[model samples]
Target: MNAREVMLTIPVVLAPDDTVAAAVHKASASDLDILPVADATGRFLGAVSKADLVRHAHDPDARVGQLDSADILVCHPDHPLERLDHDPMSSVPHRTVVVVDEHGRLCGMVPWVNWAVDEARTQSGHPRSPMEVRTLSMHLHWRCLDCGYLSARAEGTPVRCPHCGAEQSAFALHTED
Candidate 1:
C-alpha cells in the first residue's frame, strides 16, 4: 500500500491566523506532537509543534503563521515508502510527515511511528505468502568481517552491509539458534 492508504486524515490542523494558545489547546487534546497549518483555502503552509508554542510561551497571542515551522517533510500521496532513500522525518524536529496533493494542499499526516510500523509490516510480510512464510521461519545471523557490523536476515546475506558498506564476501554467517 502507498502512503495515502496508511495516512491519517482529519488530522489536527491550525489556521495561520490562529494563536499559539489555540495551537497548544488543540495539541493537548490530541495525541499528535505536531499539527498541520493550512490556510482557509486548504493550502498547506507548514506545521506547528508543541515546542513552538512553548518557545513563544511569553507571547501566547502570537500568530501561528509567524511562528509555524517550515522545516517539515512533505511527500506526495502516491509516493512509495521504499522509494525514500532515508527517513526524512528523522531530520525534522516534529518527526512527522505531511502528505500533500499535487496542488500542495493538505491530504493527510503520517507520524513517524506509523510510518515505521508500516515499514516493519511490509518488511516482515503482512499476508505471509507461501514463500515469505518459509523465509520468515528461518533466521540467519550475519557478521561483517570488515566493520564488525552484525545483522539478522531471513534470507542470505545482503550484497553489502547497510552500516559499513562492506561486500557480502566480507561477511560470515552464524546460523546458530
Candidate 2:
C-alpha cells in the first residue's frame, strides 16, 4: 500500500504566522510532538516540533515559521512506503514524514511507527492478514460485539477487546459502504 493510504489524514497543522506558543498549544492538544507548518495558501512549508518550541520558550511571541525546521522529510502521496529510506543525517529526529501533493499542498502525515509495523508484518511471512487487507481495500470497521466499541484499525481481532476486555470472538468486521 502507498503512504497516502495509511497516513493520518487529520494532522494538526500550524500556520507560518502562528506563534511558538500557539504551536506548543496545538501540539499538546493533539498529543503530537511535531506539527506540520503550512502557508496561508495551504501549501506545506515545514514543521514545528515541541522541542523547538521549548527551546524558544523565552520567545513565545516568535512566529512558528521562524522556528520551524525546513529540513523535514517529505514524500508524495503516491510514493511507495517500501521504497522510503531513513536519512541518518536528518537535522531533526522525525516521528512522522510529511505527505504532500503535486502542488506541494499538505495531504497527510505518515508515522514512522506505521512503517516499522508494516516492515515487521512483511518480514513475518504472514503477508497482510485478511482483516488488514479488507480494511485497507474497503475501509472496513471492526466492532466489539460485547461493548459496541468500534475501531477503524485492520490488524484483525485482538486477543481481547480494548474497551470491554471481551474475548477476540466478540469482534466482528463491518463496512460502512
Query: Each candidate's lDDT (Cα)?
Result: 0.63, 0.63
Model 2 over residues 1-177: C-alpha lDDT tens digits? Answer: 566777787457899888876765565445344578888788998886555665676787999888848344688988876566653233423346788999999998865533433554576564754322222335346655455566765676577888889776555553332
lDDT of 1 at 40: 89
TM-score of each: 0.60, 0.60
Backbone clash count, each prediction separately: 0, 0
Any runs in candidate 1 off by more than 4 Å, and if so which? 68-70, 87-94, 117-177
The TM-score of candidate 2 is 0.60
Clash pairs, model 2 backbone = none
The worst-scoring run of ten residues by lDDT in candidate 2 lies at 130-139
